[model samples]
Target: MEHMEQYSITIDGRTLTAWEGQTIMEAAHDAGIYVPHLCYLRGLVPFGSCRVCTVKADGRFVSACTQPVTPKMTIENDSEELLDLRRSLIEMLFVEGNHFCMFCEKSGNCELQAIAYRLGISAPRHDYQFPERRLDASHPDIFLDMNRCILCARCVRASRDLDGKGCFDFVGRGRGRRIAVNAEARLSDTVVDVTDEAIDVCPVGAILKKRVGFKVPIGRRTYDLEPIGSDLEARRRPRAAAPTGGAS
Candidate 1:
């Protein structure tokens, strides 16, 4: 692999080095900082749909996933204001989509749920939208439940970019937006396979394999083990304190 140039950037109070063209989130991740995000997966291109990764860069708020870092850039993450904003956004998602998380299959494994837990969002402050949604179980091996969908575009990007099949896409506009398969009306008409990345990439219970009764017992799932971003936080190699001059 070619060596990319690196430089320094400040987050909160600490300074760290980052790749030349990496997004702010990427740089922060490399430095063991966990910026909460939903639409920014590691491998696929960074989609800034979910603004939960918002940060203050040089005093201007920006999405860390899409905002590329610059030399000497100073970023504000985990501030009280930013935390409240993220918490509010998460709460809105919960109420807008009727995310009855307690009964949802993706409760523990869902990124939305995990992020909400990490942000200490016990309940949303907004009124529930209760938008009516559809559910499709026409496929023999897959199920589509729009109720759990956050419209993060992970499935759309995965299907088109990684799987090389433009099976999943968005239809409608504004609050009427939804995931639409290339099929005539249902996923059974599309060429989506059980093993496709699109099926596996859904961060919520929206897209799931059929006939696989929840095998993983509760209390052992992904977020159940730890709060979201704990893995990256663990990856951080603690910086040793600077040496005191002559023991003062």
Candidate 2:
């Protein structure tokens, strides 16, 4: 059997070696370049819904989380075109979703909110197309706010990969799209365990812990104290090494 290729590539003008099959965002993180992202959950398949981590490679806009690293490829991490696209995506996320920062419990700590601030997005330029959504707080600890969801599908992927339970899936397409529980059951009724890991996997306040809803003041929240990427990187533990004699 042929092995998956591995190669060295350059990102943000920095050269690094990585497996060819690994996504560019994974390679960037390994190199400490800190490309922004929202829908990418580690150990899960890339959903490419958030579009905050779009980068220019070979003169095209592609999601870094889904784009595979090519040997000797040149990646522009913060090019003008890429940054503009990112800003536009962030703005769209702000307006498309029911992200009322002033009233949100994750006002300061949200990944979506932090990336917007990081990119100098003062406020959304377009009109707020507010859509009415029901909040599913029936669960004992997990809160599923459909209005705030960007439909990033991190929760869906996490349910399948890390949790070994495919409880969540995308329900619709395009504008009416949403992440829904399997068989249309409420999240509280799913067979899967709603651990903090699932909550942490969410990039926005769509899913949160009921216990800590109002515990931290908005002024003292996470991103208010540290950058979003910094907090995420801190959570990055080392991957386990491969076995030495693995039938190579």
TM-score, one value per model = 0.93, 0.85
lDDT of 2: 0.76
**Per-residue lDDT of model 2, residues 1-60, tens digit only:** 346555667777766766646788877776557788888766667778778888888777
RMSD of each: 6.4, 4.3
Worst 10 residues of 1 by lDDT: 239-248
Estimate the TM-score for candidate 2.
Answer: 0.85
Give the per-residue lDDT digits (tens) of candidate 1, residues 125-158.
Answer: 9998898999999999999999988889999999
Q: Please give the lDDT score for candidate 1.
A: 0.85
User: Looking at candidate 2, what is the lDDT of residue 84?
Assistant: 82
